[model samples]
Target: MSSRISTTRVHEAGIETLQKRQVELAGAQERLTSGKRVAKASDDPAAAARAERALAGEMRAQTSERAVEASRTAMSLSETAMGDVVELLQQAREAMVAAGNASYTDNERRGLAEKLTSIRQQLLSVANRTDGAGSFLFGGQGAGSAPFVDAAGGVQYRGIAGERRTEPATDLPLTINGDGVFMTSLTGNGVFQTSAAAGVTQAWIDNGQVSDPSALTGSTYTLQFSIAAGATTYAVLENGLPTAVTAAPYVSGRDITVDGQTFRISGAPASGDQFTVQPSTATLSVFDTLDRAIGQLGTPSRTAAQIAQGNTDALRDLDQSMSQLQGARAAAGEMLVRIDSETGRLADQKLANQSERSRAEDLDMTDAISKFQNLQTGYDAALKSYSMVQRLSLFQYLNT
Candidate 1:
């Protein structure tokens, strides 16, 4: 009577296994259908984290790409503008050479002057160039205004201070500065100052009753000097290589009462030997050695001595201008080459970033699909087994 039968707990533990399989199958199917591995953090926490990092990296790569692109644009503009300047300078040099030849007639010179004026205007245009795309090639960051403007016939830069960043890449960290620093007259002192060149030669010139023309006398040719408006002191090759004259310690302006005659020097006097007051000294618009050459090229029907003076000084100033222009051109060419090299490096970096991002976040379709099919098979088996076990009641047992 106390006989006991071995009884099973009627447990559906297989259901649990089935449920887990179902979850896996659903996830795999989702990945296969949508072509996405980590749609949400709940799907796979580890994958979610990895995806986030990849996404952030991609965004950063894009930012770097944009930055490099901007730098490229700036370099292109800078190169073009500089090229124009070079061509203009070359034309100017040619005109100057023609001026050097004695055969250049007045009519020919007038034509050359017109050509020179056009070139000068073109040069000014080049200097005042702008990207006009909310930036300036010659200017740096924080640009609030145009990079360059004309101030009293000279160029003035009013843009923000910035440095052109080197192409952002994994290679060498280099930079390009487009501040027009090389030949920029305002930034530093070259041979002379940019202010109008007019000064009094207080040193003694020995000539006539004043002193012997070729004597080392301490007597400075004391003459009152005052420069008229729109005039500059181009040449001051004093009798001897006297020291620089300043008006600070002594009276700077020409207001000294020399003897009884108050002879005022409007501009710097040529020499005591040849003294005749003229209205204009030389160039009124420009005040450099080039401008001096223009003054010397005039075939004036005036005095023979005046014509000789013009011819003599013109050639000397042209030589000086050539040296200045050549130096500036060389510097610009060097900078352009640097920018081009930097650009290549930046492009390489962008490509590398793309590869890295793809590796971290891309899905593998073949592997995902195979895993999904296996999970589906396991779930089907569990469901069928659960149904079969449930139907094994006493009624069904009797029939069996």
Candidate 2:
């Protein structure tokens, strides 16, 4: 097949070869400049798709990081506020203890009451603390304004009763429940409450404890004392029904066990004096506890027995409020710990996403530069060959 090649065909073929080489060189230069293996979907469809997915994952990780930051700020503020609340409650407890000193005059007790009132106001402020962005730390889910407000009855929580969380893959709390922190504490000893009858100044009852959890019936119990025939005796009544311990010898400051509860009643009691014990199911407000203690301390006409009873009850209630506040603070601390854990996890996830994106689309600089140089050399050689072929003529070739 010895066919002579035409100049027109040769010129067209040489031009096409140069154009193809230039295009390849340009593509290599573009890749090197952009530092990306797949600049567009046309370059590598599968690699581009993988890079897109990785980029989306990176964005999500960034969003989660932002959420975690917001949650951390809010929870840190809340935890600090809870700590302040605990400190204020402890101060109130100290004031209550000072008020219990029998040597303190009525005026001295009133001064302690004033101190407690101040602490109460401080506690309310802590409960309504903000995140510096017009949001409350203990606002629960949400609130239009302040969460806790001082009303005529006492301090009340107006916020929702649950926590608010950040919006991201890692859900984190932004607020704590004001109601749980400040309103919903158990009364008395957390099991049962004991109280002397009104006008029974001769005797006082101590806060009772549970002796046997299985024997508890949650029934109301009444202890009636009788001074008959020069002997002191007491009778136990369970929900107004007489028990087998009728006319038991009355001993002052002796432990009296009924059902599953145990308590002590000190001082002499006249005939028909009564004390009641009931289950501690009632909710006690921290503010109400402080108010009662203040009122008791401010009263100057209370007998010794009455004062002792008031002190006992006030201390018990204060301890309960402190317990509740401590629990809430502990919860806030735990939330902060969780936030830290989530932060570390999100950081690792973000790093992984970045690595995946780099693997999918990022160019290897060393390999890319070498390939670009090779492409440049090939394009230059093609240009030189085209020039030499263009100079070739039929007469010059025949003379040679």
Candidate 3:
């Protein structure tokens, strides 16, 4: 069956076609303007989520990069400071050698002592060094103030024994403890320092070097010498508890091994003379070592033997101190390397994340422009076709 065609229906269809073309043109315009393929979440939810996650990780990497920078600065400062300590100790050793010359008078020795005193003060200043923000560098966890303080005999370490580490990467420690750098003691001699007990004048004591550092128990020990059976004998005490039932024979020029540490006793001693041994702790003050050097080289009326012992002990202690500084410098260098490596890794990661995010969210400008032009041409063709269709009539088509 044939039905009559309505002109209104044709015009309506043409209008609908124009409207659809207009919507397409609007969407193409939006993409070109915004420079993003998915400006709205509904455009591509999964792609949006991927881009968001990548951007978040990039932010975290940027934060870690900042931390690495700070760690690098800190490590640099530590390395330089340790270098300064090494130089100062070397100077002190050279001064000790000069003081040993017999040709130098007592006044000359006093002059050398004054120089050493100045050096000790300088060492104290170094010990109390601070970072750029005025925080103590060697304060361990106690960064509030100076770590070393003035005490009765010499300077003492007032800082806590620990470290502050930075996490530039997961589970990585980027800082070293101050105790490890400042207070490293090996076993042999100087396991404990020696001094003449109160009310005793028959013997002079020198703080020996550590021979075997690992076996020390950090306990207090005492050595008391007495004359028995026409021989000098000494008793050992550990923390005020008797270590032996009877005194051991004191032999001159023999090494006394106690608690895995070896100490030497030489020369004649009076009855009731005593010496004490204090266990080495995890930390030692560079200033204390310097102060001892100054005292040893400065004191007047020191006998030749006493002077010789002091020089020997000072040299040994200074060598150990140098080792400590070197170790610290090496540690700082290693941390610097870690920071640099991590920073490079973070930079590369950020670049990759940026690329990923771009792929997920950013528009391809060339493709977007091309699409806009194509849609514009299509819209123009639709408008022209719609105009032609509107002018068409049933009689006109039948005649053609």
Candidate 4:
């Protein structure tokens, strides 16, 4: 009987119960104040691990987004630079057309040539455009220096043949090649240059270009000049076979018309002098064509025939260059569209990841507050009961 109602044992039980209640109350208060269900891994290890993984994914996505943005900026700059190039090429083309005017004196044509030189320099500057980080845009994985250099009286491409891409978005090509944009070669056979035959030093392919590419047979033709009874005549041969077309009288300083083409011969040609008219398959640089135009304009006493030929060649090369510029611009525009689309995707993905992380670890304020109030009521009741028990005697409840 003494053991069951022992005063010391009762006091010890009361104190232990009160202490447990107090600890529970304090823990509840902390949870309410901090507003986090899982402040540490010990609180909820699985939830903490899930939140950590989501956060890591979100960070990676953000990094990729930054790279995409950088690529977009670079592509925008490339398009702008190419646009400027097209404008300059147009200006050069107009100058070439103006130089062809027969009424313009040599001095006036010289002014046009000077203007062309300026345009070429400006084009070079445009081609050597860089990103915000100062890396060359068209360097094609080469050194950061200018890809085009003035060498041997013409511009040369020092960069590699292809473009370099960016990290994180390796599928996207970020840069344009220098050769494709600024140094396109001539089309057709390698006859961009013309030379007079051994005996016919004065006759050449003056300003000769294929006016109509579709009409070209790609066959070599020969001009055989014959002196019949002191009257000069020349017949064209298609692969050593003479056509039914009769030999026409040769007149100095006049154009000889053949197969929708014309040739002007000023210097005297002896009989049996042969001239070959072959299509050019070799490629020439755009800058070379510009230089040729300038050189033609600067030439003193160029006949109307020479001016006409120069006009045709310059205009053709300019058209080709403009076409190439448009192609490059289209590619850049496409890349911009892709970047924008992918950026939208990344933004959506980041939001999803954040939402997952929040669900895993964020506190529920309503539940936490209710739990704190319950623990507080329990703690107050336990304190009052412990104080009463400590003062009560063994016979108190029986007497009452």
Best by lDDT: 2
Off by over 4 Å in 2: 395-400
lDDT of 4: 0.77
Per-residue CA lDDT of candidate 3, range 158-229, in tens?
Answer: 777777766626323434456656655542243565555655433555555567667778888888888977
Candidate 1 vs candidate 3: the lDDT winner is 3
lDDT of 1 by residue, 1-400 (tens): 6965432444346566667878888778877887776577886677667667766666665666566556556556666676666566567667766754566667676677677767766766665566667555556554556555656645455655446454444221112233333223221011111111132122221111212233323223222222335232322223333324322122223442222212222323432222221111222222233444454454444233333333333333333333444454465456556546645654565466555545544568888877787888878887888777767778889999
lDDT of 1: 0.48
Q: In model 1, where do residues sit more than 4 Å from their true spots? A: 1-17, 34-51, 105-107, 132-134, 140-145, 160-361
Each model's TM-score? 0.59, 0.94, 0.78, 0.75
Error of 3 at 119 (Å): 2.3
Residue 362, candidate 2: Cα error in Å is: 0.8
What does candidate 3 score in Cα RMSD to the true structure? 4.3
Give every collision pair in model 2. none
Error of 3 at 52 (Å): 0.7
Model 1, position 303: C-alpha lDDT score = 35
Question: How high is the CA lDDT of each candidate model?
Answer: 0.48, 0.88, 0.74, 0.77
Error of 3 at 77 (Å): 1.5
Q: How accurate locally is residue 277 in candidate 4, as Cα lDDT from 0 to 100?
A: 68
